[model samples]
Target: MDAHPDPSAPAKPSPDPLAVIRSRGYLRILLLAGLIGVPVSIAAYGFLALVDWLQEYLFTELPGVLGFADVPLWWPFPLLALSGLLVGLCIQRLPGTSGHPPSEGFKAGGFPQPRELPGVVLAALATLALGAVLGPEAPLIALGGGLGALAIRLIKKDSPPSAVAVVASAGSFAAVSTLLGSPLLGAFLLMEASGLAGAMLGVGLLPGLLASGIGSLVFVGLDSWTGLGTFSLALPDLPSFSTPTAAMFLWALGIGFACPLLAWGIRALARIVRPYVHAHRLLVTPVLGLAIAGLAVLFAQVTGENTGEVLFSGQSALPSLINDGASWPLGAVGLLILCKALAYGLSLSAFRGGPVFPAMFVGAALGIAASHLPGMALVPAVGVGIGAMCVSMLRLPLTSVLLATVLLSSDAYAVMPLVIVAVVVAHVITGRLPEPPGRRLSGALPSASPSTV
Candidate 1:
């Protein structure tokens, strides 16, 4: 046969990957996704549990046991310093460099290599448990994806790469679905972040959706069985927000304008500090941690609020912040915003964890502060702030809007219009803003593009 023989022959069209949906192998893939969801969800639950317990013991209970009537102002300094040392060591010594850098912004895909799981686990534990201003969702996603990919390799040594990617995404979906308080929210997040859309979006996300649905049951079952609740995000008992006013729309536009500037500052600070972190992981990391601790201490001293409010990811504190916003002095709320933003930026530079909750927290703080202004209600202001800030940072408008509205389910519909406006505005502004100089972490994948995966 001549090498050029095919040039003269009629060209055959390539097989459609979507056609797999009609094949029996697709059933196997779905079954595998469901099966993998079980283990991944269990592991995710356990990881969250450990992190929660450690956070309580270290930040809350340990202070009482140490004979301090209240947590001392200096508590986080040493703890965060230790966290930096451990995280630095993990990055320098471990195989995977401890997962992706948060400074790169939120990434949707890129399953971690199995060998890197330990570094991801240990670094995230140190970052989260010891009061770094980041969330656990990123680690959960990476760990789940890695585990799912590993499982497929063992189950079918000859599995195609496409099937492995689908299953890996399924595992990620199962891992964070309930944590966001809904499988659909997780689906939206990954879908938007992964840039899935059109018919291809359905094809790519089907397996993940099934995995997350099954995984939600696991989360609920475990919560009921063990009396340890699913660590889901939610906001309850807000004052009623029934209608959107002209003033509310105005505030949404203003917030949409403001959030991008704040988001830009945070990322700029992280990028400026990141080069130093890379140059001296051991020394600079802990110094940055100490600086974060100093900011928390300053906020506590000024506001008479607990240092914990500024120390960790803002998940546990977010509800209380909003519910009690009216009771807070405007000056205190402003101080909190300043302190948390600084601490969050510092964490992003050198720590290893997700950026979602801290950004949400900052947004909520801004909203609560803004509500003190004329014509701004607590619920709608909070929704607008959350949507704007989230989109500004995450650059996923759909996920940001859902997060803002869904968490406030009682007022979801009422706030949807404003949230949509804020999300779109922030998304556009963030896109037009210049990005910081790029600095990829050692052994980390390149940052994700906005284009389709």
Candidate 2:
């Protein structure tokens, strides 16, 4: 922190806020965020780890009274019903934890109050533990933001709006930096997702990104030393890609055509499910969850094989989905695609989680389906489908492209070109495609719904 030129200080009237941050008190904000965010992030890690421990302990024990017994699908029904009831009661009772997911996007302006942290953590933990179709990013972000805001309250009594926002943003960035494997990925995600385009983007975003990058490194180093599974978005052997043939280009066109229809369908189901959840929140939510669980069970029992296709988060499933899985029948793969999409949609409607993983899964399934049709290589098809569908759903081409390229190994080199083509095609197609008849308009996760991550 060297003395920076203050554009306004020359006038003897004001100090440039940006320069003030860069110089002045010497980016005490970063120091403040670190002091608070380190503990908050570690706490976030601990909270998730605790949830894992409990699930292993409680969701697996022998069936018995008050033991939270390992209930069959049917049993989770009543138990989940009770859990939903409790959750609903808690939500209604505690609006703090039930506020909203960070996937709703950061405001880039306001800061969360100190009181909001606990509810954010608990709600996310409980919702995730109950096998929601979402990820932990929301809770982690919310906790980080809250902690940073709390620190700002203590350190700089007169911290301006911009200062407070940076702290919160930095905290969030730090919290999930390593979760996604790269700080650049997180930075790009926040930059695009926050809609922080303009002169101000770099001023506010760079510091936050630096914090997240450091935090990600810290998480990686700690996890390596501690041997605790740090949930990271990486696969060592993602498929290799061939050049984009004319057939692959046609596939992109096809995905572009179908992306909106699929996106609309998912949105429609979530909206339909939302009302029922609202009506009998306590009962319907768990019942629907149990129904989803039952579908998972039936898929397993009927298929005589466990694909875990409809299980919790889909982030870790990408590598396996791309690997030696070409053996699945086209019909079966297609059906799984449809079932998982519906499950994901319904899960999105009621459950508290992010839609990114489920959307990615749907894209992968669509790709697998397309590749299985005939001569198309499985790897390229998957990449194209991922880009096309993800862009359509999230309405962001860059993020989808990163997802497509970064999720691969050697293939990303080849995959990058095709992914861009697919994303452009899908973005156009989705925009042109009419909303379903009598269908509601669906925005992206945070923009449209409160629940989605």
Candidate 3:
């Protein structure tokens, strides 16, 4: 008889895509994920607290001790110059070159080696506390990954490289969950950056979700216990928003079109500054810091708002920009955008922190100013601008949308359609834009290139 007779028999089923994950070892990984979260969350919290304390002491308390009621317009000049020197020393002398360059933007590099953690922490602390226009996310990611790898090596020396990577990613998920105010959002950000997909996505996400959930709880408990409030992103008391109209859609398109150009400009400026930074870091970095300080002074003198609005990563100042948009004149808002954008570019080229928050702040300022147009409302304008800018800068549309909308509380759902449109348009346009020219110099600073350990 022909073998074709076997067709009558039951067909063999295809194996489940997740069969490998369903194996016995996965449960162990899951348990380890939960355990890793506890210490990672605590470490993340400590890092944020230390940065906060340092910022206050260096910028505020020190000024008071010197007999000034508040930081003077000239204060940041010297302060930032000193910060640059210290940061430069850390990067040049320390291993891991004090983590990756901000110019490369946010990337999900795998776990850092054990020895690299100190450099990452010290560099980030210096940059953030000294008022660099950068965020804390990048350093936290590096720290979490480093710690995770170290833990794995100590506990299971023979663990496969793949297992180490999974645990490291889980550790990162825990580290950032609290900062973003949502474990889900943090997971999405990391997942997108890592390019995880399909069966692998599900497999990877399970442990990460476990770690992030526990981490968020740890953040809550710590916040409650210490009364210091969580370092998570929050925007309280947002103004109500109306349903998006044709006029708002039109404005969204305009913002979508404009933001890519802004992103390109920032990238180009950073590329241009990189060579100079590499050639004369100690000099160029300090000069860039002074330039940032000068911009702050100019913004303050012109807008009469506190210079603090223009300095640092712009995380704490974002709420004021949104809530106080109506009170700020169009001219003042415009000046703030100009100053912050320039400062942001300078910081990216020379500093050692993430680029997310400063970009958001600049975009928020742009949106608030655009609200002055007849059709645009404050809430929609703010949401659209942020989404568009973030997508352009970070190239992660989902994370950008969540970040822009979630801050609006209940208004998030209402404006989400508009935010989506803006983000899509910006992301597409950004992709079509030409890449920045390659650096002429070879074998430059370790952080200058995008490669991660």
Candidate 4:
């Protein structure tokens, strides 16, 4: 036997996942991520634009054109039914089951395959544009990741899986970089969802960070060029709040305790409804839409508020709800919470969008209602409520805390302590709660990724 190893032999790959950070191939991936961010961001912007236009034309313009003084109480019934029909078709007939079900809660597991993008997009459009109570994040993530992986495959069909995954993640990072109003917030969300930490986390996140930075520029540029606002989350002109009181901490604990129970009930209803919806999607989906519409209509009738308050993802309406918090009656706010939660649960069971905004809306509503309490100022109460509810629903304590504070930028420093306390309490409570019986459907895609690569 030859004592010397052959120079011609291929070397074994290093077991250390972080080794990729030092390789020339990783540099190539970084470059590709940068390049991909442009197209991915543009695509994401276009998708949001289309969703916005469709929503306006169908819900607002079309209603006016049809001679309605305002959108009639029954307006959403047929529109949502149509949405359900389209979404059902996409989920049943197309690939990828119309992306992950919102009922499964937020996650960052696998990206949709390129072939699955059409179904995901169509389903999300139908769900969101037609007034489903879900947001746009999940579909955006799927689109970005799918496009990224597809681009890489087209360039080098034989690319290794690790490289493909990294590029795909970068694509997702770009897609949602501006959706949450900050690239860092989006990064934090994906990072927590990604289950990466320490050295591996750095290696996994750098390409995505680069891509997200570029994506934000593209998003801003597109908004300027097209005169279409970036669909980023923002809550401007919030009432000033500084100094956390002793009473506020007690309020935080109470709100935190309450939020988990509310979240649990919402999720429990969705999970129970999901199996039945999947079993009879064609029939059940449209019915769920009608039910959601009924909830919105009922809320409108009771509160004399616009049905929009309870109909969609609540991203747009949230600011108005908070900015004009004093104008809303306590009874109306409470009713809004009840109706929106039902609509949200129904949407989660059968729709194809995101869970974040609706959850936030509910949290905001809860906070607004709680603001009526003595010794609880509106701003701190809202901050605590939002953080608690978000953590309860998302199980992402850090992201939930940041999300609450980021929206209240001026008051973030004062609110941070309360937000943290609420989030921690909610997260702990949520952890202790047992999973609902048969929470996951058969053949459901797992939501957590074991490896970032």
TM-score of each: 0.94, 0.84, 0.94, 0.94
lDDT winner: 1
Tell me the whole-model lDDT of each prediction, alpha carbons only. Answer: 0.88, 0.65, 0.85, 0.88
Q: Where does candidate 3 stray beyond 4 Å?
A: 1-17, 437-443, 447-453
Q: Clashes in each model (backbone N, CA, C under 3 Å)?
A: 0, 3, 0, 0
Which model is ahead, 2 or 4, in terms of TM-score?
Answer: 4
Q: Candidate 4: minimum summed lDDT over ten consecutive residues — where?
A: 444-453
Question: In terms of TM-score, how similar is model 2 to the real structure?
Answer: 0.84
Give RMSD (Å) of candidate 2 vs. truth. Answer: 6.3
lDDT of 1 by residue, 404-439 (tens): 999998899999999999899888888899876556
Q: Candidate 1: give the clashing pairs.
A: none
Error of 3 at 276 (Å): 0.8
lDDT of 2: 0.65
Please write out the lDDT profile of model 2 over residues 342-440, one tens digit for every residue.
777766666655666677778888888888655577777787788887787777779888877777767888767777887898888888876533323
TM-score comparison, 1 vs 2, better candidate: 1
Candidate 2 residue 215 Cα shift, in angstroms, is 1.0
Clashing pairs in 2: 97-119, 104-446, 354-453
Distance (Å) between predicted and true CA of 37, model 4? 0.3
lDDT string for model 3 (316-342, tens) is 888887889668888888888888888
- Misplaced by over 4 Å in model 4 are 1-19, 437-439, 444-453
> Considering lDDT, which of the candidate structures 3 and 4 is the better prediction for this target?
4
